[model samples]
Each structure stands twice: as C-alpha cells, then as structure tokens.
Target chain A: MNLDLRLDTSGDFYARKFQPTKREDTLILNMGPQHPSTHGVLRIILEIDGEYILRAEPVLGYIHRMHEKMAEVMSYPQYLPNPARTDYLHGLAWNWAHVAAVERLMGLEVPERAEYIRVITCELNRITSHLLWWGAYLLDLGAFTPIMYAFDDRERIQDILQRITGSRLTYCYYRFGGVSNDIDDRFIEETRKQCSRMKPRFKMFKDLVTDNFILRKRVEEIGEIPADTCRKYGATGPVLRGSGVPYDVRRAEPYSVYDRFDFNIPSYDTCDAMGRYLVRMDEMQESIKIIEQALDTLPEGDYIMPKAPKKPKPPAGDVYFALEGARGKIGFHLVSDGDKSPYRLKLRAPGFSNLSLFSEVSEGVLIADAVSILGSLDLVIP
Target chain B: MSEENAKPEKAPDKEKEVKKKEEPQVPKYTGYDYDCFLAPQELLKAVTKLDHADFFLEDVSCVDMQEGFQVVYHFDRFSQPGRVVLRVMISRENPEIPSIYDIFPGAAWHERECFDFFGVRFTGHPNLIPLLLDPEHQGPPPLLKEETALKDLNQLYPDRVHTPVSPDSEEFVKEINNCSNQKSRNQS
Candidate 1:
C-alpha cells in the first residue's frame, strides 16, 4: 500500500460554501470550532487580505443540544436543570428565568424571604461569571496569570454557593416559587465574608490587570461598536452597557428584589473593547453591592413556598420572561395548553444575538484585534 | 404559493375585521404591554414602525398551532421598558412570512433559527441557512408537533380574540408608538 501523506486542500462544507470576494489575493481562513480564544466550539470563517480581514462569518451549532426541544418533552420540574446548562457561567440567572417564567404564568406568590435568597445567590453567581470572563478574556489576549487569580475568587464563591446550591458550576438551586434550600447563618456569614473579601480584590484586579499597559493596549480603541450598532444587533448585558446604553434588565425591568438594591449600571462611552472590558469589571463590584444589600436585609420566612404546586399546569396562554445574565439578557417564551409540559418553549440565548454582530464588527479589523473583539464580547455560546 | 393562498382569504377576513373592531383582549397579567395580531403583509410595516421608535428586537419565536403557525416577534426599548409582541398567523400548508432582517438586522439569526426548527420560511432573508441545527440531518423540522399533539387557537387562547390589525390603521400605529410609554409592571 502506498502511503499518501498530504493535507486535504478542500475545506469543510461551511468553508467551501463561504463566498470569497472577487479579489484574487484574498485568502480564506477558519478560526475555530475548537480554537481556545472562542471560549467554546464557535467557528468563524474569515476572508483575509494579508493581515486585515475582508469579511467574517461565524458558524454555530457545534454544541447545540436542542434545549428548547428538551423543554417540550420534559415536565416542568424535570426541565429545571436544563437552563443552567445553556449559559453555565451564569447558570443561576438562566435557572431563575425558567422558574420565574413558570411562577409568573401560574400566579405563584413567592415568600419574601425566598425572593431575597434568590437575589443574594443570583448576584453571587453573577460575580463568578464576570470573574471567569475577566480571567478568560485576559488569557485570550495573551496573559495567563489573571485566570489563576480569577479561579481563586471563583472557587471561594463556588464553595459558598455549593454549601447551599449543592453543585458548584451548573446550579439548579432555584425552584418554581423559591429556592431549593434555605440559607442558614453559616451560608450568609460566609457569603458576607466573601463579599467584603472581593471588594479589595477589585482594587488589586485593577492594578494587576485593568491598568496594565499591555492589556489596555490590546483592548482599547479596538472593535468600536456604536450604541446604535448594539441596538441593531440586539446585544445586551455588559456588551450593551459597554456601548453606553445603561440598559440592564435588572434595572430596566427590576426582576425579583433588584429594585430594592442600590447599585449603579456602569457604562463607558468609548464604545471600544476597552469600554466592554471596563463594564464587566465595574459590574462585578456592583454585584457585590447587591449581595451585601440583600444579605443585610435578609428577610425571615420560607425558602420555598409551602404549598407550591408539585405538578404545575399553567393555563392555556403564553408568558415572556427576561432577565439579565452575565453575557446578556436571557429570555424564555413559554406557551402552555394547560399541560404539564410546555406546548412550545423558546429560549432567547443572548450569546446568539451577541455573536451575530461579530461578522459585522470583525470586518476590516486586524486579525489579532478580531481576537480582542471576540474576547471582549465574553460569549458563552449555547 | 403562500401569497396566492393568503389573498383569496383577505376579502372574507376584512368582513370579520369590521365586526371585531373591539379591542383585542389579552389576559391582564400575561406580561405583555401591547399585543396585537397582524396580517402577514403588515408585519414589515409594524416592524419598521418599531424601529423608528428606537425599539430593539428581542427575539423571534414561532409556535405551531392547529390554526396555523403563529410567529411571535418581541420588542422592547431602553428609554421606556415595555414588551410589545406582534403575533402573525401563516397557513401551515405554505408557511411563509416576510423577513424583518432589513429593519432589525439582529433578526437574521432569529429568523434562521425559526426556519431551522419550525420550517417557517422567512422570505427575503439574506442567508436563510440553519443557525442551530445540523444541515445534513434528514427529518422534518424537529420542533413541529405531531399531528395529535397540535392545539388550535380556541383551545390555546380560549378567551382572546384573533383579529388581524392592519399596520396602516390608526390603532396599530398608536399602539406601536405608545407601547413603551405605558407603565411597566415593575414600575407599579
């Protein structure tokens, strides 16, 4: 047998079909369905003229698990674990959106204490998410030390969360009307300690990472996305705030006890990767503020509603619920036909919209800056 | 094929439209500030109106019902937060609706997702390929209900009316303009 050792010159179906410009010198490149900078299995096909990108298109669906389809077949309680799997970084927010949507549809009244618990735990989870994004983003831009610092804080928060939430990363602690486990004094005390501990770390994070000339040089004035562009693509969370919109679902919509908490939605008018970077940095501090407020005023009552429906059958209608996740706004549109399972369940993953704008933003930028742009978006592709 | 099927029914629909001029009744606590049914032709116009009002498209979701395919478009504004849902019904035999990608560029991905799952074709979409489904997979759209599992409009929306409001009408324009101005649930 003759050994043939030559690379396959032809590309995959997506790359082959990717239309190239009429220019003769333009070369086609596939960034990843496995490249580390993408954070997940997201593939971006690029048309390049030397170091500059002519056009870019992202090919998704490598990790699509069809969670919406799963929601239709599973019972309400059985489907509780699915949302957390979608955006694992901010798992609690997705978990909250699922439970809150059902609660809104069935007119369930959550105990005030349970509402406060949700707020406290959810903010903690948000901190972990932003921390991970911060570390991973810095790593993407060629720095490795920050991730160690990120996971250090992340693990402590996870330890506190695990004491109550049971599991560490992909949490399913939230139930329909309230949380699964009540936070004892130990849990609250540990959380308060973590909150106070994180305050000084933010200052250190600024000195060690944010103000570093190399990191700022890599991100600042790169990938400038106008506020109008964000609206056009429906990007949300820190990406939208980074564009100077100040439109956070927590503030604009005020879900749970968020209205009672005093925290500012930080926005930067620079509209570059630096703005997006600063927004996430500022947001982690705000999360600590919200957690501190919720913990201070922690109410007294049931954690989960006493007689919450074990087998909820919402009336025949539809309800739309949206909450701000770390990456962006996570939405759930549930249509029920008076059934135990949803008639149709549609999940509005923020990363899908946030990532869609990449093809447009990545155009005409240097390939290295393109990586900077993608990292700043902080995508957890579902 | 869909255009022809939609046209013949227009004459009779207009007759029903006059009798049902009373406000479309949605449940008070359904989380929708402004909900209206629009004819397929009026969808583009209504979306354009929303774009002019500085509203951002949240998502486009489609539900399979016995009556037809109910395509839902959700929009909200940053300045004034209120959800405006536009429901348009299209025949299942030829499930086609005009794309809003031109008006709201973000909708390109959403419309593709709808097409991928429900097989609802969005006409005029630039790249209508599958966004989250395997392109080589062999099957009907995965989200389509089995014939036995489908629910009709009456069963699903028992108490509400299903009249299509023309986008050109004063009520439609006023609703689009004032949707964000309405007090949101959280504000109360």
Candidate 2:
C-alpha cells in the first residue's frame, strides 16, 4: 500500500517543485499623487522587496504649470508675480530675489530705508517659512497637533506682513529698485512685539517635537549625504548648510541690506535628515535675531529708489544677482537689451537641485526611509 | 567692506559719480572679460573647460526664434555667487548638442525637458526622451518650433491620421535593457 502511494522523481523534481529555476524581478509600484505624506503631488516609483526598497525614483512635473514658458511671454514687470507660485510658502523671498537681480542689472541703487525694510520683511517671511516647515515635517513624521499651534503663530506674522504688503500667500512686494510699500511705526512695533512673543513659543517647539524619540530615530542617521556629494550635486540653502558648508548667499554675496545686518549663519556637519532639521530650527532663531537688528536700525527715507519709473528700463547687458532665500540660494540672471522687457530671464531655483539629490541619496534606503529623507530636505518641489 | 565705507552715505543720489570714481566705464559691465563672448559653436567646449565649472543647469528650455531654435542654459554657481549664460543655436532639421550630463548629473533631467518642450536633442545623453509631454499627445508639443514641428509631422506621416506613441515606452525599454546587461555583467 505504501509503495503504491508514493513515487520519487530521479531529478528531485518534487523536492524543487515550489522553487523556480528563475525568478522575474518584481514590478515597481507608484506610491503617490494622492498620498498626504507626499507633501504635494510628488509621486515616487519604488522597486521593493517586502519592506526594503531596491530603487526609488521620484516622478515630478505632475504640477509643472509651465511657469518658465509663461515668464517668457510676459514682460519683465509682469513676471514679478510668477515666483510666488513656485514656492507658495516663501513667495516673498523669490519676489525679492527677482527684483534684486533686476536692480543690479540696471545698476540702480536701493534706498537705505527700502533696503532695511526689505531685510525686515524677508527675515520675517523666513521665520514663517521655517515655522511652517517645522509643523509640516513633524506632521509628515505622524505628529498631527503641531501644525495648528504652528499656524496660530504663523497667522500673526501673516497678518502683520499682509498689513504692509496687501496679500497673504502670494505677495509681490518688491520693485526693481526697492520694496512695494514702506512700514509705518505701527507695523514695525507690531512685528517687534510679535518677535518677542514668538521666541518663547519657539522654545515650546524645541521641547515638544525636537526631543521626540520616534522623530529622532526616523530622521537622525538615515539617508546620509556626505558634504562632498552635496557640493558636487550643487545642493544649497538649508540642505547644504546642514552638511556643514557654512556658505550662505547672504554672507557670500550680501544682496539687499544683508551686509549691514549681523547674524550667524547656522551650519552643522552631521549631513543627516535630522541634522538638516536641527539646522533649520537653529536658522529660524538666527532669522529672528536679524529681524530684531533690522527693526532696531530702521532708517528714514523713501521706500523705493526715486529714479525707478513705473516701467523699468534696465540697460542692455547681463546681470546675475542672488539672495539667501528661505530654501537656499535664489537668484535671477537677467539680460536686458535696454528694453522694457528682459531679453533673457534665467531663474536659479534651489528646490530643483535639492530635489535631484534625492535619487542619489535614496538609492539603497527603505521605502519608508525615503519619504522621511525628502521631508528633511525641506523642499517645495518647484 | 563697503558697509564700513562712507561712499554709500556721501551721496546716495550720485550713483553715476560713484561708478565713474570706482572703475572705468566699459561698454558693458566691468567684471566680465571682453573676450569671454563665445560664438554659438564654441559655447559647449569653452564652458566645459572652465575650472570648477560645475553647471547648475537650473533650467534648460528653448524659445522659437525667427532665425532658428535658441537653446538657453541658465548657468550659475550654486554655492558661489558668480553666474554665466551659454546659448546654443541649432537648425530645425536636427537640433542636437553634446550632453552636459558628464559635467553635471542634474542636467540630464533638464535636457530631457528641453527635448520634451523644444524638440532639441542632446547627442551623448544617457537618456534622450520626453519629460513633461504625454507620448499619446496628438497635438504638437506645446513649446516647440511650431512651423518645424508641422513640417516634421508632414514628412514623417503623410496622412493626417497617426498612431500616438507611449510617452514612457522608449525610456522603459532602454531601462530594461540596461538592467539586464548590468545583471549579466555582474554575473560575469
């Protein structure tokens, strides 16, 4: 009965029945276009095994609204509003970068009062940007409560900035040679008061999420990008400083009234996602310091250069000007043919380069680790 | 530092006076050398030869010039402040340039974008494919040499009816081939 029931194969086919002679690689899976954790419409195609990722490729341009193309068709003055949409959080920083470039190209001088005001507004915007990032980054790491608390303080800055600039999210507040509006005594006093209030709240931020063990473990040592690799890829801003570069465009080039003010450029050499997080947090404090100094030395003059007319006439030549934006080095390379419209306009967006570094950094990282790595880079994905 | 100097305070209105006293008035800006303006043909080689010449190819799209296609590369130092521009002109028939991917890894994706928008090609690029356009798009590429694209479509397909190509098909095929070759090479 036993002999009749069983039969053994000569090649051990029965022993190897469940095993395949060859296994086809698994197909890559698309992770987002709808996922809230993606920050935006950023989609990542991951080739993974179980939970470990073998390859992670980010698919961008899902939101490429042809901003550059639109910039080409519009006049020089008309293109001012375009930068606001690129990074909605840091719209003013981009607006400042564009105007500063045009001012340099035309060889125009910004008034002392305008310069100080520009610095004050940009620094305040930078604080708001960092605060939003702090809340969003924490939210991405699965903490939900900080955003409302962060937004509560952020809205005050928004209200103050809006009172001066007239728009909340996409404010085009810079002119070719100066700012769109001047800050009155009441506005200056309100900003100064807000800074005093925000300092202790920032301390609360440090205590609340900075020391959370899960947050630290998720971001601290994962996805380490070395300083040299960072330099080669041309990473800038908080990402570059996070790797210990200490190269801030505000210090290096000194656009606007940045040279007149005194503030430390925060940098750390850890080169991890957590290192970036800490650098940005420290940077927010430094921004507040700069704002305080700018407010204390608020000058007396016209808000804009008197020579600049309603329509800008930048003489024929190329001028490349940059500013230290909240994200990184935001610059405008403007070529004017002595016309009302620019001959050629080149925008140097920091988010583009920062996003490119992700494919390299996330090569062997797990899929879960990749999202955390991207959040740490603090990009708006222009 | 200029911050310590009294020149800015002496006369903020005397901008022209300051420039005249600081340096000789040139035909253009004083910092750029007169000899640095390269012809369209020499742009690629000249830029590639500069010391520490990493290209922050921030954006690489083209405009439909009356003469032909003008491919512009917005060059800047990401960490440093210096910036430059390099423009290339290519005929509508075969628009191509030596890929700058070897110089800057970030440029490859930008080059694909140029291809997608303006139909220019980078000769030595590892991937010369469409970036933003849908392959199945029947209408012409949104930002191409409009007349040239019409001419191309007429020559390539005499009939008005044409089958659309899958946008990522070519890229997918090439990636698969490369992966297999890499696996075999690893085995060897």
Candidate 3:
C-alpha cells in the first residue's frame, strides 16, 4: 500500500477546499456549477451524514464576468445593456434600476406616459420571470408537464414584449429618463389579452401542481425559515413574504409610478417552503392586476423623455435606487463624479442577499428537502 | 442584551414605538429614506442598531476613490418601510472594518464579495474566502483603484459634506444613538 494515498489530490480551487473533515462517517458532495436543477451556474457544497445534510455552502464566481468593472470602463450609454445580463430572468427590473438611479442623480423628469410604459413593461417582464420560476421549480421536483403549461403563457408575454422592446430575454428597453420605445395600441391590446389569458392558467396551475398532495409534503415544513431568520439573513421576495413579513419594496419604498398601482403584497406566515410557494403563486395574479390597471389608466404622452440626454453625464453625487424585482428589491448604488461613466456602480443583486441564507436554511435538512428549499428561493444568480 | 430582552415581547403596536425610540439619527438624504456617514469603527454598532430596529440589511457595497474606500450598507424596514444607508470611509492603506455578520448573518457573503473586489477586509467575518471571485484570481482586486479611474471624494459627493470621524469620538456614538432611537419617525 502507498504510504500517502489521495484521490488525485491536485484539483481546482473548490475541489481542494472541499475535503471531508470526517472521512469515516461524513461524505462531501459537489452539486454542479453546470447542473440543470440549479437554474443557473450555482454550485452547492454539501456535507452529509447519510441522507441528512450536516452543512451546506454555496461556492460562487464560476460565471463572474466582472460587470462592476465593466461599468467603470464603459461609458454611461454603453453600460445600459449590461445590467440586463446580471439577472437575465428579471432583466427589465435591473435595467430600470440602473437607468432610474442615473435619472435620479441627474434630476431628469420622466413624462407621465413614459412612467406608465416603464411600469407596464417591467410588470410584464416580472410575470415572465415568475412563470419561468414556477415551471423550472416544478421541473426541479421531478415534474415535467407544468413547464410546458408555464411556457405557453410565458412565450406569449415575451412575444408582446419583443415586438416593442426588440429583445425577448435580456431587455435593454429602459432609457435613462424613460423607455426606449413607446407601447403602441397593438402592444397594449395584446398585453391585455395575455393578462386575461394568464388568470385562468393560474387556476389550472393550482389544480395541476399546488393541489397535488405529493408536492405539498415535499415543500410544507421542509426548510422552514422563521420571520426572525429571514430578517437576520436578509432574505427578501417570496422567501421573506412566506416567512410572514409583508415587506414588498413596491409598497415599502414606493419608486417611480408604483404608488399609483393598487396591488396587495401576498404574504404567508407558515415560514415553510410551501409558504414561499404559495406567496409566488398568488403574486402572479397581483402582477396581472397591476398590468390591467396601468393599461386602463395609460396616459397619452411620449414614451421616451423628450429632453433625455443621449449620453448622460450626471452631476457629481451618489444615488441608491432600489425597485421591487420579481425576486426581491433590486438596487443600483451609483457613484458619479460628473463623468459619463460611473465612478462606482455597485449592483445590489437581490439574489445575492436572498441566496446568502442557504447555508443556515439547509442545515439539518434532508438532501431532497434541501433541493426543494433551494428551488423555493427562486434564485436568479448573478 | 437590549435586543434579546426585547425579543420575547409580543406587543405588535408598541414594538414600533420602542424601535423608533432606539433608532439612529440619520440625515435626510434626498431619494434615500435616511443617510448617515460613520467612522469605520462605528459600522458594526450602527448596523447592529438597525438590525435591532427590524431593518434588513440590503447590500454591502464598496466604492474606491482618491481619499479612501467607502463601504456602503443599505438597510430597509419591514413594518415601517424606509431606506437607511450607512456610509463608512476606511483608510485606503489598511482597508479593514469590524464585521456585522454577528448581527446580520446575511452580511457574510456580501462582505466576502466586497473583500474579493476592493480587497476590504472584515475583521470578524468567520468565512472571508473569495465569494464571487475565484481564489486563483490574479493581480490586484478587480475593482482596485487605477490612477485614471480614481475620483476625489469631495467631487464625487458634492452635495454631502464629509466630516472626519475619529473612531472613539463621543459625537459619533451620540449620533448613532439618536438614529437608533428614531427609526419609526424615519418613515416620514
């Protein structure tokens, strides 16, 4: 026998750091920076004692593209499309957060109609994000049919958005002061039709998935996170709402024309994965209500601000603009020194804060239950 | 121990009142709910006060400038929704501050990310490994201050005046106490 035997000891950074402390009873497992169940490039390190997880740590930066560094080097206009790539699921929200932060710092006034367009498109994009999360989460839990149903509604909404915004996935529709293009009659009419169409699909989703008893057991009471835990770990979106706190960034800190929209922030006090699941299921309906209301009260004016600068050089100051993304509060902390490029552009990715609680939540949970809890978080890792 | 004592209290209506009393006295920064600058040492205390006030830590962001590195912590309330930002300026040479992970457990990853980028160390962070950066990452921190990229702090924050804060100054502690006492009143 070899004096010192190792399982090919020389590996990458993560592999070297991931050795098992107790070789006899404990096993360490790596679960993909390239896995489909992860939704994106998320690698979770799990230390297991038989079937129960003793500890779990997420190792990130596999896909870190240095977007913050890009924001510094790229001019203001050149950096417009970059934010969308950060959270591709709710691209518009990130885009709006960046543009809105710049606009606030510059003191530029957006027209009434432009604000409404921003509201409508952003909400539509949010519905798409939730739909995908719904479909993908179910797929993660061994269900394949619901994704087909979800994509049915998601594609149609994306179709309406594409005709106006000119992109389906990573949208750069929002400009500094307003939207890139005006929403025509066709876009509004088609959006209204889709909103009406999605209402019943949600009912069908409940009957097909939410009502399923097997799904309930997998989620309910599994990975239970109390309201105090959520606050301590700073988890937001449905994760926080599910834990019984009715904190919605839209209602909490009203930004743009969100105050004009009337929609309830759905919350559940169960503090379980099932609670988070229900909160999101109900939120899709609330988003639809917002879209319909905005269309009814859609004021007539230019979608893009008339005096909006082509290459904005905002005055020297720091502005932190946060908006309610489909996942949580998306914030853009912009520090400008009267330059076209941001001196410091810190993207407060909601997923980053929301995902930080995974280690605490996954502790003492079954491996399968941990998977369920991760999906319920609705992560769009940046 | 103020926090642990107040935890078992089940009074919902009075919870807001007590929280408001202990909240910090943050200056009214337009667009933000409350804004205050803290010496590097006060970062942990101010954040702990916010955590006790039921405010969730939003993000831990860093800005590299000519003077030093500015670490920004954004927080918001659930019961009474408001944004509070604590800006702490650390000397560029040392670039370390006391960690708030003991208070807000969520700050763990955020602090690591800041460490990965601007190379700002959180003194008490348990796991300060590379979060969003590969440990094999070469060169200086990706967002390190390049000569051409640096901006004067005064020019960057034209509207807000920077009053240098000594780590053990009485004025800083008093300001934090006032802000901690007035959290609910911050809603306005």
lDDT of 1 by residue, A321-372 (tens): 8999999999999898878999998999898889889989988999999999
Better of 1 and 3 by lDDT: 1
Indicate which candidate wins on DockQ.
Answer: 1
Tens-place lDDT per residue, model 1, B1-188, is: 99999998897998785454333333346667888899999899989988988899999999999988999999989888889999999999999999998998899999999999999999999889877898887899999999899999987876667998888899877876776523655343
lDDT of 1: 0.89
Error of 3 at A177 (Å): 1.6
Over the stretch B1-188, how does candidate 3's per-residue lDDT look in tens digits? 98877767856757875575344322233456556787776666667667666788888999888888888888877776667778888889999899998998898988998999989999988878888887977899989878776887776775575774543566544543344313533554
Cα distance off (Å), candidate 2, residue A99: 1.9
lDDT of 2 by residue, A3-62 (tens): 665554332211222222232664456677567677778766666666766666666666
Q: Candidate 2 on B1-188: residue-level lDDT in tens?
A: 88768766866758865464445211223111111222455555544543244434445545555445666565444444344444555676777677777777777777777777777778888756555555445665566534532223222112223332222345322322232212332343
DockQ of predictions, in order shown: 0.36, 0.08, 0.30
lDDT of 3 at B155: 69
TM-score of each: 0.93, 0.78, 0.90
1 or 2, which is superior by lDDT?
1
- Tell me how far the alpha carbon of residue B91 in candidate 3 is from the true structure, in angstroms, after superposition: 1.8
RMSD of each: 7.2, 15.7, 11.8
Which residue window of length 10 is worst by lDDT in model 1 chain A? A9-18
